[model samples]
Target: MIIPVIMAGGSGTRLWPLSRTAFPKQFIALTSNLTMLQETAARLDGLSGDDGISPMVICNEEHRFLVAEQMRQQKLTPSILLEPAGRNTAPAIGLAAIKAVEDAKLASASNELTEFPVLLVLAADHVIEDVEAFQQCVKSLLPEVQAGKFGTLGIVPTEPATGYGYIKATTSSGRLGRVSEFVEKPDAETAARYVAEGYLWNSGMFLIRADRYLEELKNFRLDIYDACVKSMASTQLDLDFVRIDKEAFEACPDESVDYAVMEPLAAKGEVVVAPLDAGWSDVGSWSALWEIADKDAQGNVMAGQDEKNFILQGSENCYVYGSAGNDGSGRLIATLGVENLVIVDTPDALLVANKDKVQDIKKIVSQIKASG
Candidate 1:
């Protein structure tokens, strides 16, 4: 059974003003009519197999209502798992895998299924324009995942992106290859060289058996494994959400899935990388958002409102994300001869930045938090 584990716990402050701490990017409709969370759930519509099961979502407790409401909008009643605090993806997925294993065991007792479920780990806020290609990539990795190989979908680099981490594959030319190493975000020159050498962007998407992931987690990070096990065992049902014990989960270490499992396992040749050429973007910053969005002849993307709302005289290659009716700002943003700028208008805040410096938007967010 290919059960999706959607990781939706992130405060997307980089796309700030639009994506707030209370209502992050995953819950916003940045791409299409559907919000990113809804799109994540909707993307699996046509995927079917005898072993396929419904999706399981792991999100922040603060966004529990938002998650539930978004899923309800799509008529998808997924098993929503709520974390007490943000412990990063490692513990979040670890606990989800543990719960999936328990559910599988219960089903086995009832003769529903005899095999362990394959967990398709996906981030909630990614934008993949090519759904068919994405599904094909996932289908291709199913057998390898069922065979106990940790399969990570690596995005084929369209550019030397310094925003995303790169996954170095052992072989350079195939759709799938053994992962050699995982590299952190690099400098511009280093990123360009990595692109030339054929390194894939670490997509953070994985397909692996639930039990297998638990086994590997136990082997690689016993502390995280044990904490997740304990937390899952004491989970409480709250309406449609499963709430883990706050104190128990609070004791868990904060780490990403890369550090807790994949990096160590990749070093041991246990992880495989599936190169995905599907148009994928994490939308890490305003510049990234501009890169993917459709632009006018002047290379300006006027979000929230239409071109009529944003009167760009000579603004070439700029992104203006104005306040929608939801923002309650009633603000109309207009640009002059500005080029390569990002103008975001919100109810409580407004940001105007250079496109090249958008990556450092997080620093401004950090400063705001520090002041408070």
Candidate 2:
């Protein structure tokens, strides 16, 4: 049995205005009909047959309703673990690992079960176009993972993307090899060099046996491991959500799973990289969305527009109307002649900026927080 753990905590300030603190990137439908979270969970359906395990989700306390609603729409009542605060992937997975261990215990007692539990941890915001191939890649890594190896799915780089970290791997130790190193997001030349050297995008997708992950967490991040185990054991089960003790969770250090566990385990454990070629995109920013968006003849995106009814730099495609939103204002914003512009219409905040300056949207988000 392999339990899929979806990590769905992100403020998404980079894709700001549209993606806010209340509604993060995971819930946003940036590229597809299905929201990113929905897509992430749906992608794992094929991998959860009778022999495999059902998915469990770890999300922010604020986002439990959104997570549960969406999962319910798909008729998937996932075991939801609500974090009191975001202490990064290490804590998120720590909670899920605890729950997965309990689940494994329950499964072991059941007459229908026949296998140990493997945990596939994934971010809820990622977009993977090729579902079957993604499952195949997960299946391929199961053997190593079940053997108590810490495995991560690394995307074969299509370009030198500075947004993502890199995993350096080679086939020196049987099928699964020791990770040479985990590098941070590199500069242009360095990213290019890493790509040339055949480094893989650190996709943040992880595979490990449920109980084994707990053991490693105990070994590496002892305090977090101990506290999380205690918290989950005495956790408050509220309907679909498990409410972790806030003081207990906040006491844990704010380190990512990669830094707190994975990176350190690189040398000692069977840290292998599974090659994922499934058109994966984290969609961390608005520009990332624009990259994958359908464009018009003038290379302008339909969602990109200049509001204020002012004509700016962009293809002069006649009257370009922006959605009159950001407060349900109902003000139809139309530009006569604009080129290379971006207009985002959200429920409470509207963004109108140069398309080239979309990356700077975080500055606006920061100001809003500063003013408060």
Candidate 3:
């Protein structure tokens, strides 16, 4: 059985103003009428080969309706697990795995136990154009996934991008070698060196058996395992979501799955990588959005409206929205003199910032939260 787990709890601060606190980038119709979360779910629909199974989603409580409603839009009735609070990927995945295992146990009248589910964990905000290639990538890993290996998919890097983390891999005798190392997002010089060395972008997509992942989590950082166990044990089925115990989950560390599990599992588990060159993007910044946007001859990406004459001028590689001023949904956003800038307009505010320093938008988000 293949169980898909979609993690949808990111604060898309880099896409601020247009993507606000109440409704983040994942739920906003940025590139198309479909939101990022909707696109993510639809991508899975394209992976319908080799008897793919139903998907289950895990998200923070605040995003419960957003994730569920998006899935519903696609006509996919997915089971959702809402974390009472954010405890990162490890605990989130753990809760989903626990539920999958429990549901697997209530055997059908035929008394046939289901195959240990192979979890295909994906982020809800990633952009991948070649849906065919993405599905092929998943199918290619099925053999290894069934062989009890903790499988991962790696996106072929298109550039020496300093914004993305890299994965070093070696192949021998037609078999993918172990994960050499999980490197952090490097500086410009380091990124160039890594690209020259043929490192792949770590796409954060994993394929692991429900039981094997839990076993490894138990063996490693027992702190995570203990907290997840308590949380899942106290989980309740509410409406369509499995609500994990908040008090127990809040006690769990806020470490990411990369830092808490995957980094270490590179040595402990048989971590293997599958190459995916499907025009993937995390949409981490304004520049990334432009890279994936439809561009004109002058390299101008005008999405959502006629952007030939932005409210300002001299602006190239900028994203502009003209939501109304009364509600911040339809305001003219023309630039007279700007270049490499990002202008995102929403009902409550307008964000104008340089493209390069987009990562700092999180600081502004933190400040807003503190003030509120």
RMSD of each: 1.9, 4.0, 2.7
Whole-structure CA lDDT of model 1: 0.87
**Which pairs of residues have clashing backbones in candidate 2?**
313-339, 313-340, 314-338, 314-339, 314-340, 315-339
Among all candidates shown, the one with the greatest TM-score: 1
List per-prediction Cα lDDT, in the order shown: 0.87, 0.76, 0.77
Task: Select the stronger candidate by TM-score from 1 and 2.
Answer: 1
Q: On residues 278-301, what C-alpha lDDT tens digit does candidate 3 reach at each position?
A: 899998777788888886555666
Error of 1 at 150 (Å): 0.2
Error of 1 at 7 (Å): 0.4
Model 1, 233-269: lDDT tens digits are 8889989899998998999999899888898889999
235-350 in candidate 2: lDDT tens per residue?
A: 89899688988878878788788887887787674588777777888887666666667666665555423334433354532212244444524444544456666666554666
Candidate 3, residue 157: lDDT: 89
Candidate closer to the true structure by TM-score (higher is better), 1 or 3: 1
Best by lDDT: 1
